[model samples]
Target: MSVIRTAILGYGRSGSTLHAGPIEKNKSFHVTAVCDVDATARQKAVARFGCRPYDDYRRMLKEEPLDLVVIVTRSDQHCQMTCDCLAGGVNVLVTKPWAVNAGEAQRMVSTAKSSGKLLLPWLPARWGSDLQRLRQLVVEEQAIGTVFLVRRVEGSFATRNDWQTERRYGGGYLLNWGPHIVDPPIQLLGSPVKSVYGRLKQTINPGDVEDLFMGILTLANGILVQVEYTVSTESPPTWFLQGTRGTIVVHGTQLKMNARTPAQPSDPTQYSTMQAVPDKMLEEKLAGSLYGDEHQIYKEIAAALCGETRYPVTPASALELSRVLDAIRTSSNENRVVMM
Candidate 1:
């Protein structure tokens, strides 16, 4: 069998639970190494994968001839790690906050372009059936005329209190969770942001970064998106969309999408909603979520990079997210609308 040698650069919780297991299961990709800064974590990663361990990413890329390097480390290290791997002649698939700001995203994008290496964001959220259906619905000229509003809420009691509390670490409610929630809206809207107004409140985190954040985005195409999120919430989770036709609301991981999009008579629009439910809900790309059959994500990504199919997590999409995030932070700090 032809398998791409893949290295996972972090073996933390998200890395272990979400990424490694799934990717290893793909059969098309071999888990060549698992990396982390802590010696104990490295030992465990090595034990788990029966692969070598490296304290430094630079060392890993230098010693191992890899087909792909998946970055699951902190925000500060993401860009440098990505650049290093690309410069080392390896393809990269890294976690979000692709950079600290839009400028960083641009540089990374430029590097990927020049090196001819694939750089895609780790937004598996886009891999779901519901979002793809929504994207398809928008493209097919559905009742959701023009996609006027995309309102999303990324709720978690664990996130804000955990790694998201510190701004210096690129920690915050938005930075931690906003990427997944905001991806669909931006993709559906397909409009470059024109301006943004933001509101930030430090609800739980004792650090400089925000805890609960909300932003109003005005796209160049005149689409408006509202991103509402918090790190502390026990309420029923919700992620939703609205257009001229109707709405689609997915409550949680049950593939439970309650949709009301622009009306479609005799077309069984609800079937589209029902069809949008993902057969699986994977928390990370390298691991299986709920059950088996978890190889599609990397298979699709590798295929897309090799010009066989389309990979949903494009660098352009990552750039768009960063741009919106930059505008939001600027608007919140300057106390005025900022143009993107």
Candidate 2:
């Protein structure tokens, strides 16, 4: 098998640590070059990876022979950079928010389709251990019968004066932490969102954009998923799964579950307002690490590049996420539920 030569754009934030670190750990990928405008970051990249560094991304694209380009720049730059890379005959693995809106995401997707290049979104949450376990229980084993509601809550009491708090730079909790928070429930629900009702506020951040948001997604299967990402003082359970027979809650690394036995009606005419029937309710406590295999996504990317298999995260799915995000914004702005 031949190693896939790769280049990275942006080194300050996720470019080096998130993109380069994983690529370097995977044997199928080779970091051929790195592009960053920061002189110090470029020097650090050379020292760490021993790869040539360029200040200009286009110059690096022109000079280097690369199979893949990982774009980890500001959210606003994702669309254009991805299109440029696809046009240059290199597959793109861009981090979310892949685009600020669904229209931009469509352009990126269309460009990749026209160029015959792979466009993958960096959605690591799909491979998270908690979600994988949930899938096994809810979908395969039917441990939790008929999932109806799923909730993901993540946030802290804090304020940042960084670029992330500003709208012009494509910075907000909605774009920053929203993708990771939203992907798992969507995958588990296995349905396209039918409508979105969202509320965004600028609570503590100094930016013009909202620092926190509460987004309610009603899926096609009628499963309701609520996502609350805030910078406020309240910290809730990380995850909540409610089904017909059971409920699951995750607090830190611990998962607690309670499954009630199915109650059978003995008589056709007897309708009791309340009756306690004990059929031995199942209770479980799962305690341990709640992290997925870190390099699984990179391994899959290598396989996809080798034509051995298709990348699991499809362009259409990523675009759907973008569309959901767009609807959330619309709902928040207009103060009404937006239909898909």
Best by lDDT: 2
- Candidate 1 Cα errors over 4 Å, as ranges: 136-141, 144-146, 157-161, 231-237, 247-250, 253-294, 305-307
Candidate 2 residues 128-197, lDDT tens each?
A: 7778777877789777679899999888888889889889889988888778887778987789999999
Best by TM-score: 2
Q: How many clashes in each structure?
A: 14, 0
- Candidate 2's C-alpha runs over 4 A off are 265-291
Cα lDDT over the full model 2: 0.85
Error of 2 at 224 (Å): 1.2
- Tens-digit lDDT track of model 1 for 21-49: 77867766777887788888888877877
Q: What lDDT does the true structure give each of the candidates?
A: 0.72, 0.85
